[model samples]
Target chain A: MTNPTAAMLVIGDEILSGRTRDANMHFLAGELVRHGIDLNEVRIVSDDRDAIVTAVRALSEAFDHVFTSGGIGPTHDDITADSIAAAFGAPIDVRDDARALLEAHYARTGMELNAARLRMARIPDGAALIDNPVSTAPGFTLGNVHVMAGVPAVFQAMLASVLPTLTGGSPLLSQSLRVFRAEGDMAAQLAALADRYADLSIGCYPFHKDGVFGANVVVRGADGGRIDAAMSDLARDLGL
Target chain B: MTNPTAAMLVIGDEILSGRTRDANMHFLAGELVRHGIDLNEVRIVSDDRDAIVTAVRALSEAFDHVFTSGGIGPTHDDITADSIAAAFGAPIDVRDDARALLEAHYARTGMELNAARLRMARIPDGAALIDNPVSTAPGFTLGNVHVMAGVPAVFQAMLASVLPTLTGGSPLLSQSLRVFRAEGDMAAQLAALADRYADLSIGCYPFHKDGVFGANVVVRGADGGRIDAAMSDLARDLGL
Candidate 1:
């Protein structure tokens, strides 16, 4: 659990081309932050197999964990499962566990589980199923990569199921102070304070208002006491 | 105007560490599609100067236009102005045009334009300033890279100003047909239809509901007639 490094691969043409406003990226980013995982990189690619395989391989190897969103549906563009399996050099088939879930879901509601629907049950060999409570189609974990749905609701539920399984370090704690001053004015003091509180990661987020300049100073650390102390010191120094 | 290729470079530590869920990516993606621009690649990097400079150069060279969001604030971490100038090998200083805007904004609102606030007025040599109606601190464009604020509102306003100035191709037209079948069931038909409409780009979006699988087939092209014809043929083939 040493410095959980993670990367996000948003696979969707709608997102890349701007047809769909992506809600999952923001949701996942917030989740990763709360779990004390460092999300290092994010790449949004179209629903292309070559691109998905290339990005999945590169990111999975580079980071401790890789989370992918979009694809894995019952559509023509939903080729993520097969592509990821191909990247991992594994054979993909209709897994019994996933098929069972699909069957149970269909049986309960009395619907036909057609071939198009069966595509959702396909899982790479030796992969663990990630439950999707929102939808019967389950996500899977192969190696360090977790393949989840693109829809915000289903993706979030799948992420929740997969998160508890991973090993995480101390949960990242943060405190923010909304200050009515420019970042440059707080630079010297903030720098000095950040330097003093070596354990905390101090960030200055500057925003513009109705013709006013202001910044939000965020102090993050694994230690709650350190973050609190640093934030208090920052406020005192800024005369907040 | 030939293809109108574009890339987005998101500069912010908040985004990299998953502290900020970026909305600009999706917004810009949709905007690019409407403007007849092809969004090829997207990279989210930290607020580090070297990272910003590196991404700016690579993306600006590779694509016809490179748009960046975040780290353009009046804070210490807002090093985008300096980094963009450095990437272009240009000198960065307080520009008269930008300064006038900031000074006038502060004067009208009766707020002090302190040194920290004035940092927002800095611009690179030969760069054009972008209007920020939401905030007084203007974004600037150096070479092909257009820098904007991270806030969704301000970023969108800046884009409105910048978009009209850029050369764009014919606006892309899109049409969609909703099908009540799984992706795999519709895969073969969708693929065949996509081949038939070779001049158009067709996408199949799948959604699952209460043991039922359905898809929305989207056909996109420059001509409305072509898009409608493709959708009509698709709907007939799917028996919808």
Candidate 2:
């Protein structure tokens, strides 16, 4: 059976404006593959409400799960939470549970739970809170969308809490063979192999290292046996 | 005047599967902003035809320019060239100019211009050839979408050639101030400042470093004087 599909929506002007190179998309991609959920797509948009709502709506409907990073902070540009609420057409306000979490964290840290800080407590109706261990602000799961922080540490902590609770399929298995040759040299063989095993995904990634060319043929599938078979055939045929 | 808006479509299974960390997005993002093109969105999709076509069409129509990286190489999974043709309903085949470039390069490198290698020459009709100096394969531009190589060097080289040919708006100028305060502490004031300087785009990005919280207030706009004025006001108000 196919694995559950996921899409990531990264919300930030910092990333889109080249002020920050995003780490969450790659981190989530690796984590999702390890968790047996196929990451189908990833969209990074600016801190615009319309962009966020449109992208989140599209991704939430297209995939089994949608993980968003960034814009859930206590700042003018941090509009992701409200935008998400608008996308689902759900009413949002400062929930007591979320406020208490923030309040307690601020109390312990000797910081004020002011108007801006309390923005973190705003949760959409009927959404489950995803705990953030790195920071006090809790992420939330509204419908199929899991809105998390943009910070790498906080986003990781939130995903760690959310992933285990969700249903996962068999982990995707990958087998690879490296050949010190140009992609064109083995492209035909790889194509034939891909055709032979239509269920498996065979990818040829080329590299230039030490003034030499090489291609790494990776075979990915849900079945380890299928991946093994494809890799074995590939390795033997390539004389490796 | 507002900059020409652009979007990026990163087509590859390697990136989505967590095999490769995409460097092209950040590189292109930085380049575009410097070139006065506002990068609005970036989408990373797997090597699927329907997904590629859908994303390319949407991005191409939504923005003034759409830059796509990956899937233009000589591999079975590299379906970007064909997909772009399908997206614009343009016929694709081995174009003479592209083939000649590939043929001459292969001849110089002493590599056979075989069928698989020849796939690089397949350019869509009514498209301008993008010179790939790093590698022999010529990326193409069909309508507003500029199909570029995924390799860092090649992508940069193609961009260098393409950027000069396009009309660019005034270079977006940015001024930033770092304040040693939590985002919540300064968020309300920042919001007021944003309202005051409605024409300029002000972004407050928070950070946690060395057991302290801080936020970087950045003002971006086509008018350097406006950006400078906003930053000065923010600094004065925050006592920074």
Q: All models: lDDT? A: 0.83, 0.91
Top candidate on DockQ is 2
TM-score, prediction 1: 0.86
Per-residue alpha-carbon lDDT of candidate 2 for residues A43-121, written as tens digits (9 for 90 to 100)? 9999999999999989999999999999889987889889999999999999999999998999999988999889989
lDDT of 2 at A55: 98
Superposed by TM-score, candidate 1 places the C-alpha of residue A194 at a distance from the truth, in angstroms, of 3.0
lDDT, candidate 1, B1-240, per-residue tens? 357888898887787666666788889988888888988778887776886787788779878999999877665567888999999999999889999999998899786787767888999999999999877799988889899988888899999999999988877788877788656667878878878888888888777677676777788778899888888888788887
lDDT of 2 by residue, B3-24 (tens): 8999999998888989889998
- TM-score of each model, paired residue for residue: 0.86, 0.98
User: lDDT winner among the candidates?
Assistant: 2
Q: Which stretches of candidate 1 lie above 4 Å from their native place? A: A86-113, A121-126, A180-188, A206-214, B15-20, B86-113, B133-136, B179-185, B208-213
Docking quality band of candidate 2, CAPRI definitions: high
Candidate 2, superposed: residue stretches over 4 Å from native: none
Lowest summed lDDT window (length 10), candidate 2 chain A: A207-216
